[model samples]
Target: MVRQILPISALLLGSALLLFAGGMNVLILPMRGTFEGFSAASLGLLGSGWAVGYVLGCVFMARLVARVGHIRSFSVMAAFAAIAVLLSLLILTPWAWVPLRALSGFCFAGAAMIVESWLGERAEPQSRGRIFGIYTMVNLAASTAGQLVLTLGDTTGIVFFVLPAIFYCLALVPTAISSSASPRPLARVSLDLRALWRNSPVAVFAVFCIGISNGAFGTLSAVYANEVGLHLTAVALFASLPVLAGALSQVPIGLVSDRMDRRLVLVLVAVLALVADLAFIFLRPDGRLENLVMASVFGAAIYAMYPIIIAHANDHAAEGSAIQVSGGLLMVFGLGSIAGPMAAGYSMAAFGQTGLFVTSAVAHVLIILFGAIRMSMRAPVHEAEKAAFVTVPQGRMATPETHVLAASPEEAEEIIAAEEDRLAEEGTGPAHEAAAAATAAVAAATERPPRVSEEEP
Candidate 1:
């Protein structure tokens, strides 16, 4: 692991820089948009625009990496991200920034995927859990640091925009100079809705709902903080401190989830989120210290819910399908993310700062309802059969390399087939041989043909 770390340290450092930029931009952008006379609806549009590009990038950018390779793709995305930030600094118009923001999202997601892919490639199974945990910590810290960095700049000035560009440009340096071999080829992953629903309907639905709640709040939380009479520093802290807390809280939360029924843990988390949202809507705390505590509690509970949902889903996923399960849930979360901001943004537009909490509360209520519904039904999957839920680096943006684990169904079938073949070849059992042959036949029929049949028979 130490040897692995030495080679990829530069790559990881660059990833941290990229995460910092992503974090800083998230903190400042809506405020910047509002400063520039953009409406809440337009700001919501900007937020959703990023998710649109982000999810699209997650789906397709791996192919770009597969074609061009990781190093080249990383460079391309870094340059693109830096350019997008610069463009935003130059134009400073909602109309211009909207497309640039989308571009930025695309580049961020692409670069992050590259870094994670590198880490994943370097990691052994024995050390993967630790490596991913450290990666998540590093990223969470970077994002929090980025948000806090805004205290050094004037929110009303153009420096916030220029600063994130500087960080993004800085992000290009580490990976470009490192001589590590490019990561494995990128692959696409798709959710099998039927299997996922069969495994756990609540997990699937909860992931989507969690995505909506988190996405909406993530995009607009800082803006909402500002409207609620928090100063710039407090607003940044208000927005970031909770995520930091949430990341920290995951340890105990995960430990608890590991020991007991995950659904029960999820119910508690949803209830916590519901309480926080209600407080935000009604209590409207005044003291700075109190507000900090409130935000941290809210952040910890809401942000922490996704992992539980993921864990619960993995608890029942078919063997060797952890990647696909995570990917499908991620896609579902991304869809919810796009919806979250639109709903919260519109809510903010109609009802002001309080509306954000209202949107969040409603999401929590739905989640709670879903959890209840699932409790009535028997769990379809067991704890012993649970797939390992590995944590990727947080706020690192998804990239092609980072996403390779979640193979498309066809790809997964091929993988499952290959493993079966390897296992059968060494054993030499008639039953195993027959099973492999049958699986191969099924996979072959479903599998894409090696070559296109362009000529007519």
Candidate 2:
């Protein structure tokens, strides 16, 4: 393991620095905006702007890499990210910060894609799982550390902004100095609503709702924490604890999802999230310990939903189409993310700090209701027919490349063939028949012209 990791240490180092800056950037903006008297709605717009740019990066960053090459593209993205943070510091106005945040989002997405692409190229098949696991752990730690760093400094001044900027620039150093050859062009992002819906209506609908709930909380929880009168350290814990708890919960959740109907798991988790949402809205915990505990419960339930939904979709997808299914759902999630923060921000503006969870509760309720309906309408995919669940990072941080890392094309095909053979032997029931029909429909729907394609860089 040590030998395998040593060769890619530079890529890991670069990724850690990049995520640290991003983690700090996301938290500091909301805290600073609240301090500057920026309204909740404006802060929500900042989240919207970032989501929009992030989606755009997913769509267009491949072209940029193809044109210039990976290292150059990464350096450019890092530079732009640094500039965006520094500009936010200098301007200190809500209107100015919105666009700057969008720029940061775009650059962050592009830079991260480049780093992951490099890591993917370097990893051998036998060691891929270990490498990916190590990468995920490094990033989780770095991002949490970044958020916790806030307790050491005041957020109302230039220092916090400057710190992230410095780290952003430093992120460029390891990759820029490395001598490894560039990887292939980045994966293109596409959305086929009809195809995705055909493949798994529940996965499509649930992912969108998950996006809205997660987006709202990710963007505004810091503001909620601050407004509710938590000190700086408490606010940091409030924002970070849920993520950590959520990451920790995936192991057990993944094991259970693999053995039974994934939609059942999805509904169960959605119900748990709804309970948390209600607790936040009604209990309105003022004490730090109460808030932190609630946040952890909420995080555990909400964060686990994405992978369950993805696994369910793949259980129904045709062979060799896992990348398309995952990427398309990611875009759909992005669309929902664009709307989430805006709605939550307005809610808080009109109501109060608790309004953030109120908005999130509505989204979770939709997921729960829809998931339950879907569960009753369709039979569970037999255990033999299910795709093994793989843990995913948080929604905002995941890209198409993450899907590739999780499962290779060959492995995906093997899963599909094995499931198909099992269904064939068991004889097709109405549920299996419907799933087969849906798979055929998705193949036809996806046969349309490519939204975008990779070209040489």
* Top model number, TM-score: 2
Computed on alpha carbons, the lDDT of every model, listed in order, comes to: 0.73, 0.83
Structure candidate 2, residue pairs in collision: none
Worst 10 residues of 1 by lDDT: 448-457
Best-fitting candidate, measured by lDDT?
Answer: 2
lDDT of 2: 0.83
Tens digit per residue, CA lDDT, model 1, 321-373: 66677778777777887888888888988997888889989989998988888
TM-score against truth, every candidate: 0.86, 0.89
Q: Give the residue spans of candidate 2 off by over 4 A.
A: 409-457
Alpha carbon lDDT of residue 86, candidate 2?
95
RMSD of each: 7.7, 9.6
Query: Could you give candidate 2's per-residue lDDT for residues 1-457 as a string of tens digits?
Result: 8899999999999999998988899999999999999999999989988988888888899778766677888999999999999999999999999899889889988988888877765766666677788888888889988999989988987888999999999999999999865654466667999999999999999888888888888999999999999999999999999988888899899999898788888888988998998898888889999999999999999889998999999999987777789989988888888889999999999889988988889988888889889888988898898876878888355887787666653553333344344435545555445433433332232232211112211
